[model samples]
Target: MCTIELCTIVLVMSDAPRLRHQVCFALYSASKAATAVYRPVLEDLGLTYPQYLVMLVLWEQEPRSVRDLGAELGLDSGTLSPLLKRLEAMGLVERRRSAEDERRVDVVLTDAGTALSARAQAVPQRLADAAGLSPDEIGQLHATLGKLTAALNSSL
Candidate 1:
């Protein structure tokens, strides 16, 4: 008896669905792959992918409302709420109701969360190194992605 693993394959097509090769799919796949690459690194920091994105925003600014975080990340409350709860449980962030606006909730990083930044500051460099992409290539990718994202946002 013989067995084989289908390790690799490629498709060549004339009329693939627009969604298949669209910029949205490219961004989605790149995000998934990049998050996969960051998994171990982020795990070491005790954070998940969405949590890391939330942290990224909070790192740049402090005491942002939950709505602001969601808007910045293009996420809805349904998706962000649970993740924020987990972060609160971890004591990385504190959630508080606003005094002026009782309906709004603000997210503020803890001392531990602020300290975590020192360790996370190297993630971009690590990702760049792991991707084995030259600076020029990274720039080109950014330019292409920026154009695609802008077009999609405009379409919406």
Candidate 2:
């Protein structure tokens, strides 16, 4: 079969939606594809996509509380703690009691993690090149996805 024929499925019943016609499936599939594109590049930098996301926040600002990080990343302590532990073991970050609030724990990037930021500087352009999306196209997609996410989240 040709590529389009192989990729597409049509249903006679209009009421029953096809998986291929699902926005959720498209988003899920695209998210996986984006992660696959990041996998090798992230591996080269000794990072997983989740770890990279954590680093991205810390790179922008330091000493973020675990609660704040969890809120920002939409992760719970159960999930975030292990990832933080792994990054800590990697010598990329440290978790410590917040100076301002003893009850809160803050995450700080180590010197190594700070340095990794420079090495990872080219990742965005590399991914854009790999995905073959122009900057304008990327921005538009980002905006659309952001709006979709917000709308979906608000409905919940």
Candidate 3:
């Protein structure tokens, strides 16, 4: 009779930092991936991803001041002005100086923009399906990201 002996060995990992373990890179990559999924869907609606984000806020509350919109979207006038201009040209939104405050500009969605919301209602479900994440999982991810954002903002 002949007997064979088997041995197993495990290697330990180093504590050294690596690019693949970077949170910032992971967030950046995930953001790009998520935006890729949104691109085609948003294009079909005649909107870019940034424009869609603006529309989402407007859909929730119309006629918001440009300053308020900028705050909510984390954008500055320099970046937002052209986006609003394009949306205005498309007849999807209207921008006007506030009646009480000339320094303040307000953005209001057009009838077409309001109507588009009905179509956009399907976007969340479609995005969830494309991401292969359940609604609960998405919610948890959103909450976690929000916390991360808040922490970074506070640090800054």
Candidate 4:
């Protein structure tokens, strides 16, 4: 806000953007709220949202290279390494050096992790119920968010 005073009149202008007017703020809040919804349910499974995400990927395949896994998750080593360590400590995953490539490390689901997938089968339906979104709406939302992510990444 700025004020300019002339002979007998004063004018004020406001240039600051409102928090509620920011699209980024809306996205941030939604992300946090969505994570909050997952927290308790995930806690029952002894996993944080990030850890759950890692397990989801590993459940889809076996013996994935750390570098490949990180790329799919959009994470760097600094962040992923510790997360993998925690999962290993939980006996849910194992990190082993690849025999084919001495420099590469691979992540594979342990017995416990493989069992977790069956327990997690109901999770998607639970989230769907919580979201109160029709299947079509969920599909549209997923597609839109994917495009938004791609656009933002390309911009970067």
Model 4 TM-score on a 0 to 1 scale: 0.89
What's the TM-score of every candidate structure? 0.82, 0.89, 0.87, 0.89
- lDDT by residue for model 2 (39-147), tens: 8889999999999999999999988999999989999999999999999999999999977889999999999999999989988877798778889999999999999
Clashes of each: 0, 0, 0, 0
Candidate 3, clashing residue pairs?
A: none
* lDDT of every predicted structure (CA atoms): 0.89, 0.91, 0.90, 0.89
lDDT of 4 at 22: 94
Off by over 4 Å in 2: 1-14
Off by over 4 Å in 1: 1-25
lDDT of 4 by residue, 1-156 (tens): 233355224322244567989989988988897888888889889999999999999998888999998999999999999999999999999999999999999999999999999988877777888889999999999999899999999999
Kindly list the per-residue Cα lDDT of model 1 for residues 25-83, writing each as its tens digit: 87788888898899999999999889999999999998999999999999999999999
Lowest-sum lDDT 10-residue window in model 1? 1-10
Per-residue lDDT tens digits for candidate 3, residues 50-133, read: 999999999999899998999999999999999999999999999998999999889999999999999898887777898888
| Cα lDDT over the full model 2 | 0.91
